[model samples]
Target: MAHDPITAVVPAFNESETIASVVAYLIRAPEVNEVIVVDNNSVDNTASVASTAGARVVTETRQGMGHAFKAGVAAAQNDWVMKVDADLERFGPRLVSCLANARAPGIGLVKGAWQDPGDDMPMTRLLVQPAVAALCPALAELTAPNSGIYLMDRSRIAHTELRGNYAVDLDAMLRMAWAGHGVAEVDIGQIENDRRSPAHYSAMAHEIMGFFLDCARASSKASST
Candidate 1:
């Protein structure tokens, strides 16, 4: 039986150290039709390494995760898109299987969730989820609303709205949920990411809160109009 092939979209910036391995793994996946690596103007050799690893390379000069991701998805050739973090090395075939198996009718996206050993998602625990609960309640239910790895439908997500900057993941999930698309989560076990600094969390909080405020203002204006 033939199954629909998925395009793996990886948005990267200065990820030469880890990209080759990630691309190699993705290219070897039977369900993955092609790996599209969007090089976000890296000062390193991410593009060349990705290409050598069997990924179709593209460039997104805008220099942000959102811009890189949009460019990668735009170049995707499959209906289903699997987006994984370029920096993370723990993602494996199990995570891919989990996300793929979660797809069903009316589902717009599948979130690949994993336990953080350090519990260091400070922005998510402190600000993002709280703001989402107030502005986009449905999105707050997600275990990892800020998760960088997930599978989405190209047709659905390509047309979806974006809040830009660091809030791309949250923005897409919020819009999809509001658009009557079902969200599913699959536990792919533990994936330990590096601990971020206080200043990093602060910047993330600013972007996330700004997005929520924009949503609040828009909602207020809509109701009044």
Candidate 2:
């Protein structure tokens, strides 16, 4: 895909402190035409803070990343969309180029791989990510399955069937592959993120495993038919 106006979608929950910085950096990027922050029913002043930062704010009452993302995508007015987390402070402008380079011909989805080898990734994530990579072909038909950052054409959104909660990213990728859309990953440099606590990590692992297993069974049934 050629360069065009990109709408950056940020799904935020109780992210009042960091949302402004994230939106500010995104708006400063020339390639990014707009920043849409979807507040996931946050009890804090996330919407107010995002509005002060000049981000177009949308409210999703349902408390899930996928629900926020779907609202943000639906609200975007640009041709291209990039979904990013609100807590990333040092996401460089080079991220735009990375996504652009990853856009293979006929590919609508491009994911960014975190490139810092020294960065601390959770132990559970490290173990689970490999399991995901091994199971994805039979489950989501995905490579780089855990990549959360994504750049995609807006037209593809209508064809996507995003499930609620944490399974959203995996579900969307699987549907995209099933629809024959191309997907690729680009190196987006190291991100300094607050690692999830052990309890949260364990919960995430369980959720991811359940989704993967469900996908695997569905894929198997489809193949058997």
Candidate 3:
């Protein structure tokens, strides 16, 4: 996989401040052949800055993280699509190397797990992972089950139906494994992110929880039949 060219798919919305830096960093990686920024109708200069920094800018008007990712993947020219957020948190060019290294193990889907030795994040401890494990045990293989950073083989996930919101990453993990693709998780080390407002955080949490509830119901029905 090291020899294979990689495309870094970055999703941004009003991320003008960090978009350029993220694109520059991704372009520095030798494995990365293209750095595409999928702007989700940003009001700022996200598209211009990303384009200036050597990234091909595209737009996803549907207004969601999942939609941005779907658009990026669809525009990818490389067989391997690496998803990186425009916030410049928990990701860099080194991520490309890690993904390529993990590919040596014959894994088609590689998700980056945030390394928190302290294990203090309530989202992981109190909510996301536990709920996912309870609803779909196999998808629990990833510690950072909802991490936005991941590298996936385009063909393996192209046919899967991705949720249009916060649940996309978790949904992808489940669908990839169910499709018989080997999934692997790698540590992305510590992350530095721009803090979102309380209201924004709450809304994201609500959507994520709702997606899982839907997943739980689907799983129950499948097993019952």
Q: Top model by TM-score, which number?
A: 1
**Model 1 C-alpha lDDT per residue in residues 100-144, reported as the tens digit of each score:** 778888888888889887876766778777877887677667777
The 10-residue segment with the lowest total lDDT in model 1: 156-165
- TM per model? 0.93, 0.87, 0.90
Residues 1-225, candidate 2: write the lDDT tens digits: 466778999999999999999888888887788999999989999999999998999999988877888888889897578888987866666876778667767787887877544454554256446655555554333335666788887686562357666777766666666677777777787777775667976776677778778877877899899
Residue 115 deviation, candidate 2, in Å?
Answer: 3.0
Alpha-carbon runs more than 4 Å astray in model 3: 89-93, 116-119, 158-160
lDDT of 2: 0.76
- Candidate 3 structure lDDT: 0.81
lDDT of 3 by residue, 1-225 (tens): 657889999989999988888888889888888999999999999999999899999999999998998888888898788988788744444666876678754577888876544445567667898887886677775677777888888787653378888788877777777777888888766776656677987787898889888878888899899
* Position 142, candidate 1: lDDT: 79
